[model samples]
Target: MTERAYFDELYASSPDPWDLAARAYELRKYDLTVASLPRARYRRAFEPGCSVGLLTRLLVERCDEVVASDLVAAPLVLAAERAPAATFRRGGVPDDWPPGRLDLVVLSELLYYLSAADRAATIERARESLDPGGHLVAVHWRHPFVEAACDGDTAHAEIRRDPTWRVLVEHVEPDFRLEVLERGAD
Candidate 1:
């Protein structure tokens, strides 16, 4: 797993290490991620690794309630200011999942940072947290990077191995991959 201190130091250097709010690529990606949601509205949503809340802000438009979390606190502060309607928390996947059933779970640009075990655990936890027929959206950068434990395809391949999820929407580009899937009815 990516250590918390790594993110702490990154946030300390710059509030927007990813430049999620200013870059056109990021803005477009966030828009596409939100736009790809199969449902017009969701009752409740959870967004892990909601850096600076750029996507969280858009997610708010589609969900009645959004609980967004990050490993570090600095970005969560900025996220709260950007998306005041959504709840913010300091946490990450595999170890930190919200209580109750969620209608939507978003794993955006986050899975690659986790160790293999943590990534698998995170996927399982996400599945368990959702109600049957609930949606889960994942979007990640396609290129290999120094900080990532694996490439985006590798991370997503783990998710695809499960037979219970049915893909509702999929979009692949040179820079990224995005998918929206629904949990199978029990």
Candidate 2:
């Protein structure tokens, strides 16, 4: 199945398909994601696959403006309802990418859904979209899943290989891996 179809099907049956809002594991993950940021506040932030806007709500507290997107419209509706202030759109990454340079770009539990070529393109677009000294944060489940194209660790390893980004922080837990990367001056 295509990534879009898979996500659409997953959300078609359930609102909180991943239990992202109620799960203790997800809450902890969100906490760590916010904590891992080097800066307390950001001018503008972009969050892709902002499922139910759970993380988007948290991001709005620290960001002056936030632009969030999802491939399926189901979650985007919930996200819009949850965080009406945010600019919510229906589009997938690396193709339906948002315009303008961003100070913070977040890829959380989203990259593994993409094929290798799409994933690499997404990372490349992110690198190009970020302003100098901007931040890029990625968080993903560490374990293997039958549906995922690649494990989180492998995806992160590929992301780190980009010379334009410098790894600033890496948090490893039994459940997930989180990395904070800054766009390099060079």
Candidate 3:
């Protein structure tokens, strides 16, 4: 897991460490993630690691209610300002999942930051939180990076290994990977 202090120090250095709002790469990636959602509208959604809320704003358009969370408080504050319609909170995954069934859960650019165990826990928690036939979307940069515990390809591979999810859509590019998974109906 990326330590909370690390995230806090990062935010202290610069308000937007990832430059999610200014870069075209980020903008285009967010567009792809939003475009790839299988459902046109969702009753409720959860977004973990919502840095600066750039994508949260777009998610608001597709979801009636969204709970966007981060480990550190500073970015979440910014996220609240950016998308007041969405609920912004400071919490980590696996432990911070909102109560009740969720129709959409977004894991964009988050898994790689977690330890392997935490990553698995987050996936498990996400699956458990989804309502029947609900969707889970994940988008991550494909390239290896120093800060990431695993590469994006490995993260997606881990998700694909689960037997309960069915792929609804997949978009792969040189820069990133995106997958939409639906909870199988019993």
Candidate 4:
């Protein structure tokens, strides 16, 4: 059910489950995610499934307000300390989706953890939340793992099907797929 228990168990064993802080791969990925954003500045952004907030830290530099959330609270505690500038909360996607319009929504390495239906719901939620002409960026690992309900290609291909999304940037690599799409208006 959206990998909540897996995350909880992972966090209980280690504060940083994937070792996101120390990985050069993650650093490069995060940099690419920031670089891919079409706008230099955003009014408000939502970063769901933000584990440890490394990306959220960088996002705060470009966004006026950032809401970073995770299903597991243990990581949010650390994420708050790591990125005090952004607001950190304990929440999940779809069901716990936040209220209010958004200028940007980041679904980073998070979609694969959910079942196909929830993944679509998460994307739809972003579509509904976006202020017209807002941006939605999704980054996911390309390879399949035991925890993933689907591969990056499957999830990203679904995003491409949305009628309102206009592709701004599509960066594909062996390791990951990153897409920055604008909602409404070509």
Candidate 5:
């Protein structure tokens, strides 16, 4: 998993380390992500690694409630300011996994940074926490980066290998990959 200090330093330097708010690519990707939701409205959603909460702002429109978290404090502060409707927490995957049933779980630009064990645990937690027919949306940049433990494709492939999730939507581009999976009913 990526260190907390890496994120701390990154957020210390810039509020939006990835230029998520300023980039057209990120804007379009966020739009596509919400558009791909299998359900028109979600009862509750959890978004881990919600940097600056740009996507969390969009998620609030479709979800009755959104709980968003990140490892760093700086972005969480900015995220709360940007998306006041959504609840912001200082946390990350596996260790800080939320409780209760979720109608939607979004892993955006997050999985690749996790170690294999952490990634599997994160996926398991999402699977266990989601209600029947709940959705798990994962979108990642399809490129290699120094900080990433694995490439985006590899991270996504790990999820796709699971038999319990039924694929609902798939969108792939040269720059990124997105998928929505539905949990089986109880």
Candidate 6:
């Protein structure tokens, strides 16, 4: 599990540490993410590492219900305030896997922070919880960062290697990579 202190300190310093709410890059990426979804409406969706719920707000319009979570409670507080309809929780991935199978799971700007082993475990958990024909959308920054354990290419490569998932959409930019994958109905 990621240390709470790290995220706690992050939120203590700034409300939107990654500029998730204000950055034009993030706004465009969020737009692309929501657009990439094949289905117009989903019964249920899950978004882990939902910082301030910027994407969650968009997802709420497309999903009948959404469960968004983060490792620290601070961001979730803001997220809940912003999107009261979406359930917000303070929890990490894999270990804190949510209840019920999800038709859509969004992993945006979150995977690179985990070690390789944890990252793999998180993907596996996502696969396990995904309903048949469910969607898994992953988006991450491509550049190297001292705080990040892996790059966007590396994270998406791992996701592509999973046999159970079929790539549906791939978008690449100088700054980031976004991929939409669907779990096989079988």
Q: Judged by lDDT, which candidate is best?
A: 5
Clashing pairs in 3: 1-115
- Name model 1 segments beyond 4 Å from true: none
TM-score of 6: 0.96
lDDT by residue (61-116, candidate 5, tens digit) is 99999999998878888889889999988887888977778989999999988999
Q: Which of 5 and 6 is ahead in lDDT?
A: 5
lDDT of 4 by residue, 1-186 (tens): 455788889999999989999999999999999999989999999999999989999999999999989999998988888889998878889788778889999999999998888988999999999988999999999999988899998999998897779999999999899999999953
TM-score of each: 0.98, 0.97, 0.97, 0.97, 0.98, 0.96
Q: Model 3: how far is 76 from its true place, Å?
A: 1.2
Query: What are the root-mean-square deviations of the candidates from the true structure over C-alphas?
Result: 0.7, 1.1, 0.9, 1.3, 0.8, 1.2
What stretches of model 5 exceed 4 Å from their correct place? none
Shift in Å, residue 103, candidate 4: 0.6
Residue pairs whose backbone atoms clash in candidate 1: none
Candidate 3 residue 186 Cα shift, in angstroms, is 4.9
RMSD of 2: 1.1
User: Looking at model 4, how many pairs of residues clash?
Assistant: 0
| Model 4 regions lying over 4 Å from their true place | none
Separate clash counts for every candidate: 0, 0, 1, 0, 0, 0
Model 5 pairs whose backbones collide: none
lDDT of each model, Cα atoms only? 0.92, 0.90, 0.91, 0.91, 0.92, 0.90
Model 6 agreement with the true structure over 50-132: per-residue lDDT tens digits: 98999999999999999999998888888998888899878888689889989999999899888899899989888888998
